[model samples]
Target: MERLCFGIDIGGTSVKLGLFTENGNLLDKWEIPTRREDSGSHILEDVAATVKKKIADDNLVRENIIGIGIGVPGPVTEDGTVINCVNLGWGIFNVSEETEKLTGFKTRVGNDANVAALGEMWQGGGRGYKNLIMVTLGTGVGGGVILNGEILTGSNGAAGEIGHITVNPSEEDKCNCGRPGCLEQFASATGIVKEAKRLLDKSKEPSKLREIQHLSAKAIFDCAKEGDALANELVEELCRYLALALSHIAHVVDPEAFVIGGGVSKAGTMLTDLTKKFYENNVLFALKNKDFKLAELGNDAGIYGSAKLIIGK
Candidate 1:
């Protein structure tokens, strides 16, 4: 019989769970509402009940499941204690212990972004690369670092916070973290949109972005493809900041590859090409050859990594 494990990625709006075999093949997966407004314990109760039902409905035996692993969207201690998740309204959660007790299964919990990076490293974009970095550009930017074929969580489990790195320390824009000029302030989709809006507000440049008062990054990209100079400039500036930030990462970690994940990665080669060009221009001469690639697993990487956590590579 093939041994399997359960992996769960918990977000503020929804929770994704998956069942995977030891060999990294995903067997089954599902998404459920997070409803974090309810008590954290109550959410765990729901998760346990849903997982139990899924196993029973699929006629899977307990012996096949080695354990459960979870990726939470917040900072968690090295031992799986959540310090807090601003979006989820959860504070200081002992999530692993709670889930373990509720489900009678051993559980491991980790930072969602870090786990997503691990997922990519184990079976996705960073596969076969021991020294790698993953930069997730969504509403916000997050980062993960892998070194010597292992996840590099520092003494406090907060080592791979590349997004917090300052790309423009002198910029007056304040970050949600109360810092100014974080990488997320420039490279995230939110950052891109903000820059786009700023350009739209200032330029008389013809753009389809002007068609819709509230424009999305996707719309801006489409407009750029249609020859909107302003859109192109905004994207190029975003890439420049990303490249500057990544150069700093290169100077520190010297990873062999960098995988770009999250929603903006959907921009594909356009985004990658710009990032590569900028990194080449900005990074140290010794690190100029580092490959930049898009993340292969998309949004499922977190769940995939969680499964890997239980199955042990």
Candidate 2:
């Protein structure tokens, strides 16, 4: 039988599972809606059973399945315990132990953002780059860092938190982590909408964005493309903040490249071009040579990263 491995990514609304060959070829992939009850035990059970059923259906032997790797949304302890996951309603979980016991396979776990970074390093935009950073901008901003071709989980397994970095220390905007003025507070999709609303409320500029009662970052981008001056200005400001955060990251990590991922990245080259311009303008002279690229794998980075973890140290 061919050697294969299981990679699972647990999200608040859904779970993505993939079967992969030893070399990182995605053999099969599937998803299940996440059922958020009180704990993550049932979720683990669901994942184990799903993988076992798939193995049996494919006539694959247990030994041929090398291991399992999981990516959770919240902070994970060094030894694989989930400390807290507000999105999943999980607290102090032994995810690795649970999955191993349920599936009879060696299992490892890491934070979703970290795993996604590993994924990018393995086969996405960061592929071929020894050191890289992945910045994911969505409902909230999230990031992962890879150094020397390995994911850096820090001493507490909670490093690479680029989103929580303070942009304007004096500006107070609440972050999901309960902090104020985090980069996510102004650079994420939600952040863009928040900024757009602030602009509209202030009536600072005439904008077609007013037509959409429930404005989203994507809508703002659309409006900008249609020559909405306010939308364009908002996009510029958002990109400026993103560049500020990235400039800080550049000075510290000094990674070879910075990869921007998530839903907002789908804004395509428009976001990238503006981000590049701002990053160059903001970063210190010593760090001006770094490349900024968009994440190529899009949504699949997590699963790919999980698979990379299972492939071993």
Candidate 3:
């Protein structure tokens, strides 16, 4: 029988699972609800049972299966101990050990964002580049750093938490991370809307943005594309913050490229163009003109990255 492995990405709402060949071809993919209640106690068991059922349904021999790779939304130690996963109501524990016990398969776990970057590096936008940073701009900003084809998981397993990087020091409002002026506070989808509303409330500038009752980040980008002055200004500001964050990161990692993903990235070339323009303006001279590609894997990036934990590494 062909060799196989499991890739699981555990989110607050659902768990995405993929079965893949040892080399990286996804054979099957599915999702199971994350039983986050009761401290998410049922999550691993449910996932294990699902995998076992899948294997039995296919009549695959257990000996041919490689192992399991998992991605969670928190810092994970080198040995698979999850330091804390507030979103999943999980405390410090050896997740890989627990998963291995439940599923009877060797296990590895990494932070979801970091694994996503690895996925991009292996088969998505970061393909052909061994070193890169993944910038995920969603409800909040998330990032992953990959160096020489491996994850740079830092001393505390928090090397890629780029969202919390401070961008301003004087802002009164605090980010969810309890810090003021974090990069996510100014660059994420929520941040873009907050900035849009702030601009609308603070300025009397006549633009189409005032016509919409419920503004969204997409709407802002759409209006900017349509040449609305205030909306364009907002997009410019958003890209400025995003590119500024990448510039700071580039000085440290100096990766081959930066892959931008998440819901906000749907803005497409407009977002990347402005971000690249600004990023090139401020980044180190040696790092100027680095490649900036849009993330190609979409939501599947985590699963692919999780699989890479088993397949490539």
Candidate 4:
């Protein structure tokens, strides 16, 4: 019988699950609402029940299953102990152990961002590259680092926290992490809007961005493409800070490529092109040639990487 595996990506709003063949073909996928009540105690139960139902509905033999792999929204140790998941109302706990007990199958777990990186490396933009860095720029910045074909979890499982890197120590505004001058403060979608507003507040330059009351990063990029000087300046500043952050990372990990993902990545080549130009200009000569590509898997990267964790692909 052909073996199958389960990949689960648990997020704040819902849990994304995928059934995949041993060879990494996605056979089925679905989602369930995350019940955050009671410290998220019902989450694993719900997942296990869904898996059992899926197995029965598909008439699949449980013995042919490899194992379950999960991606959590927080730092997870090598042993599957999640240190804390604020969105899930979870504190430090052995996720694999509990999940195995609930589902009667061996399980492996990883941080969601790291798992997404693995997915990209296995089947997405980072395919063919063993060492890569994935930067997710959404409301905030998130990152994952892969080195020598493995996720760099570090001692505390916080190795890929590129957002918290201090880029402007003099800035008085605090990041969501309660610190000032983080890369997230200037490189994320929210950061772009913030920077645009700041620049507009201080400068007399007129542009289309001044007309939009509900400004977004996409609007700024669009205006930049349409020849808005202020918007172009915002993009330049965004790319400069992002490139500076990546340059620092390049010197440390020296990854072969940087995969840019998240909502902001929808700006497409406009974003990557500018960021790449600045990155090449700022990084060491040896690292200037590193590739910068947008993420290909979209929201499914987490599940793909989660499956790879158990299947060893």
Per-model TM-score, in order, reads 0.93, 0.94, 0.98, 0.98
- As a whole number from 0 to 100, the lDDT of residue 260 in candidate 4 is 96
* Candidate 3: worst-modelled 10 consecutive residues by lDDT: 304-313
lDDT of 4 at 166: 89
Q: What TM-score does candidate 3 get on C-alpha atoms?
A: 0.98
Q: Write the per-residue lDDT of candidate 2 for residues 1-313, one digit (tens) a residue.
A: 5689988999999999999997999999999988788565578888988998998898888878889989999878767898788788888868888888998999889999999988988889888898988999998889998888777888767888989999878886568878788989888998999898888999866678888988988999998888899999999988898889888878888889888999998887889888889999887788887777889887788999998888964
Clashes of 2: 0
- Is 1 or 2 the stronger prediction by TM-score? 2
Off by over 4 Å in 3: none
Clashes of each: 0, 0, 0, 0
Judge candidate 3 at residue 312 and give its lDDT: 60
Candidate with best lDDT = 4
* Better model by lDDT: candidate 2 vs candidate 3: 3
Cα lDDT of model 4 by residue, 198-311, tens digit: 999999988899999999999999999999999999999888999999999999989999999999999999999999999998877889888899999999999999998998
Candidate 1 lDDT tens digits, 1-313: 9988899999878889998988888989999888766655467877899899988999989977898989887777767788877667788868888999899888988888989998999899898888899999998999888887667777766778888898887889799889999989888888889888788888887877788777877877787777888889988988888888888889988999999998888888899889899899876689998888889998899999888777764
Which segments of model 1 are wrong by more than 4 Å? none
